[model samples]
Target: MISYEEVQKHVSADDCWVIIKGRVYDVTNFIALHPGGRQAILSHAGKEVTELFSMLHPSDALENLPPEACLGLVDPNTVPAQENVLTESDLQRRAAREIMPPAQSMMLLRDFEEWAQRVLSETAWAYYRSASDEEHTFMENQDAFRRYFFRPRVLVRDMSTGSTETTFMGIETSMPVFISPAAMAKLGHPLGEVNLTRAAGDWDIVQAISSNASCSVDEIFEASSEDQPLIFQLYLNKDRSQSETLIRKVEKLGARAIMFTVDTSWDSKRTLDSRAKAPTSADASSATVATLPVNRAISGYQDRNLTWDDIAFIRKNTKLPIIVKGIQSLEDVEMCVSHGVEGVVISNHGGRQADYAPAPIDILYEIRALRPELFEKTEIMIDGGIRCGADVVKAIALGAKAVGLGRPFLYANGTHGEEGVRRVMEILHEEITNTMRNIGANTIEQLKPEMVGPAGPWVGANRPPYIKQ
Candidate 1:
């Protein structure tokens, strides 16, 4: 049996070891190759990481570890008794789990969000809810959906013919809506991305696995059943070789598409997240606890110089269809089309990257107007503040091939695990069906440009400045 003293001695980049469930693992070689990056592993090097490791990894994850990496068990007598530290976050987690509303009773997506906020720790809530800078654009994303009014036709016959069934990037889906890639789902639930994969399989929707997901890509895929459609969202790393390796792995694992996120070259300034860590009178008793930094900023080999050249490298590396996510302008769309990309996800990182970034919905209209032929050639997707079924219809009418929902699913997973996720999709399914009935559309194809109107002359403050009234 190994001693804890021996493990503690090797805690640097060159030689790092960790204790997991009484077993020691020499992760020196695995550090740089880690999907979440080296720091994530290095932070807990030489320390007991059973709790965090179990929460983030699958049940069989350790079995895949290299045989040589396992350096035997720690002596029960020499190992110190595991401390059962109950901090405020622990209390909040328990409280959140205790207060989860029955999945059957959750009627709306907003219901899950409300309960998730109550249960999540202050730091997690801040990170999930916080937007960049003043959050003007963040609020605008939701409001953009409301700005467009629906022109419903009266006395529509054969409403039963309507169906939300559609295909995205040649992948059949129950509805036009799909789950967007969001990171570190373990912050909300222990199941993390596994919950997302299970729910997507249950409901026949596409699941875009984030590169930054708490669960490894293999773990998420392992939980999925055959015929369940999955895609990968990639953040190009500074190390080109590492990026190439990741792409090949995902391709081999059967990801139908790759969404290369190009917007987040620089990190956004999340002030509320900073405040949650700062000392405050509201939680003076737990100031020391909060100082432990519950939420770590997403860091890794982020390439600030990621450009079109890297796109060429990715195309040559894998045959998976490439979708350039985070496209905000006509110029970028043209560039993506010029590069022969299969699709484009018109997004702004859900308005998390910049304060005044243009809404994806607005950009969607601009793209349709400028390059109408490109829509026929390239599949267009949009995501940002899509809170309801009518919003889904509006996006389709405006020219988006499909829509993505990120934060809502995160809240769903936190509130009710896999069932919560299924319920959120169920809620959207109902809303989309009801919306189709009311709008007099029979099939997704019938949701044409004529069914929607301009935001002009609207009598709401949320309306854009260009729109009157």
Candidate 2:
């Protein structure tokens, strides 16, 4: 039996897969008959293979060669070979009994060292969780979670249906949960973003595609259902044209909304990212995250140097409603309303940016006041530190139309890939249903701020350098 540790640990240079640039390469354990023409295992032997090419020479070199057979890893680009198409048997093997992995939840949520050790390859988890400047807000985000002391409510009925189902923007979805556009999924699974799309569709939920997604917009869309509501998250880049081009592609593909991510301006400083080394593959694309542009200016100018005016420009380019993420100020909220940008997703970019920024919930009241014209037209959402059903209920009661889940779903992706996400979704669903029944609230609208209050510290409090919305 392959332990989860063994699976992740064993994926080394020797334990490799055949891949091709700009083409699909499927290694579904159909080792008996590879569509790539060569004996399956023979295909992905060495790195930097090239020029004079034949499978046998390399295969024999690996098989019958002397004791020190490893002649160093070959560079993939140098390998001048044609890509092999995946056959039905390849699909069958791919569908065949896959190696089961261990539990998804890392010890990190509870233990810092264990979490760090678990997600060694996927560094973003560690980087995003770190603290910034004085780390006041960092401490506050965690402390906020503790404040919500889980008060067990006695129910009158035994048949309580906990619903993770909720809506985002104007569309109804299975749960408030959506795939949080995590970039470079292939880093975790061979199928990459392709695998994630399957989970989203099967579960009947929305997908908030990452600005720096590993798979191309076209590729991910091809893998997902035609009717699956897609929201394209944008990182305002230094190169405005590239962002504009990407946004247009999403609009053409029928994305329901544009989630303008004001959060990620630079590559987040993560301890794991700096440490983990990746084994290269052809089919494995980097999601072009580092090169892509994501910029944000606070002035609301949208100039040759982008400002909030760019929000209106984004709206003009596409028909989708724009939800401004990375908002912590009431001033930004009022401006979004004034600019006709549609909605606001109160977030601190999940603490990936400034470590000590305000928690989305901490500043919820100030921003909710902006949408006082009443709920229907202008919507409110938040992401960060949400772990349970009560967390979902608390956000709703505090005027969040819904919430966006990031880390938990990533945990889902890492633990069981598609199945893990489905499991986490079901757990959250039951938790939500449980929260509703316990609170005696039938509809989502019944949740009020008073029904929920800080079980912990709401950071970045006091006054700001701002105007009241």
Candidate 3:
């Protein structure tokens, strides 16, 4: 068995060398999953693997290698790319000066207070981050998870048996780390929706495309591979025909689900938006957010008069499962559940619509408790302040099946396009795996509210508030 110290050394590529004939080369990443077999990797475990690689074997032609390549000795020609790539130190020297990000995540709550005071355009900061003041509901979200706490049974049998398969809306998702929708993606990055949706395909994560995207719905769906699951987000259009057109197009695109964002009837008055005068994040491509005809022959309409009936209208137009977003109260949850809603996104519209609205996580349990019968029957997803795997764990434990990540992703999409999103997702994935391993929970379903506990100090007894269940 590899000891902790050995693993560290191997990971750091220190004290370990690769040997070929009489030479040495490092193959750290390839060590564990070496196609040449564990013995070949072990052969160079403590030395260099140069001569074996330099021999110009079938491995070098790995791109043309057959499926059987994985079952035999090292192809020698198949030397790992890490063998020739620049080392960490080499890359470090060439890297640009570190520029701290303008926005912070929930993980950096300790620095949150500092971030607020930093001089940034109010609109940028607000739209980018900033939930409402008293922000108690928002703060309580973290606390709520901390309170449930995980309960792992010792010596108990793990019935999971390594398969974390779960089905949602007739589609199979490995786990619930699906995509969250974003508005005016171009405001955050160049490729915008294109970059994000494509990367989602790489990780097998579902990407919910936004209605306000610069790229039209058709383009966004086209960007994804055949295997990816797509969910089209719906925002009520000023004209019902616009909404109708959008829904029909989304259905034609094979979207797995329909998400109707209902939290914002009136535009939110974010202090950030008002103070900063941020640029229009919405796409300039179409005057409207829906798929209606752009012909001047048609007159304009208004979304201000939307009602619950519109939900039914949108549903009637599409065959996909209908999910309502932004349900904060238990009453609303019950109302939607009774309306034959297939899913509910418990959100505060990322604190953009209503200042001081209860954070989505804070109200999640109430929603869960309100519809115990529909809990497993209907899908529940959430977004807003989802930064790390811990936040993801907290969300899942609070009953979120698939969590949507917003601002941070926008920051990434703008910061480095696809690479930035890939990096961000990678971090979240690792954190999710690490969190599960640390807490002794493997799959998303196995994650429970119990994994979280009180932060630093809360000596006082808990408040006897009304819990939905």
Summarize candidate 2's per-residue lDDT along 1-469 as a digit string, tens digits: 2222222332333453333222122232333322122322443333223321231122122232233323233354444455657666545434432433343443222322233225423333333334344456655654675554333344534434434466768888876656665554544444556566777788887888876565567777888886988788886655578678878888999888998877554444432332332224643374322211111111112223557778877876788888887777667776777777777887776565677777777667554444444345478777777777777777787677777777666555554567656666666676777677777665665555555554443335422212232
Model 1 lDDT at residue 31 = 84
lDDT of each: 0.83, 0.56, 0.59
Q: What's each prediction's clash count?
A: 0, 22, 25
Report residue 55 deviation for candidate 2 (angstroms).
23
Best by TM-score: 1
The TM-score of candidate 1 is: 0.86
TM-score: the better of candidates 1 and 2? 1
What candidate 1 gets wrong by more than 4 Å, as runs, is 5-17, 25-46, 57-70, 85-93, 277-297, 369-371, 456-469
Instruction: Compare the candidates by lDDT and give the number of the best one.
Output: 1
TM-score of 2: 0.65
After superposition, which runs of candidate 3 have C-alpha atoms over 4 Å from their true positions? 1-126, 130-148, 154-165, 278-302, 367-371, 449-469
lDDT, candidate 1, equals 0.83
lDDT of 3 by residue, 1-469 (tens): 2222232244233333443443233455444444333433453454334433432122232333334322223334434345466656435423421333433232332233233223222223345554454355455544455554443444443544443345666677655676778765654444557888888888777888877665667678779999689888887777678789878988888888898888767654444433343225564443232222111101122255767788789877988899898887767777887788888888886666565666676567555444445566577777776666777776776567777776666666654568667766677776776666566676666766545433443234432122212
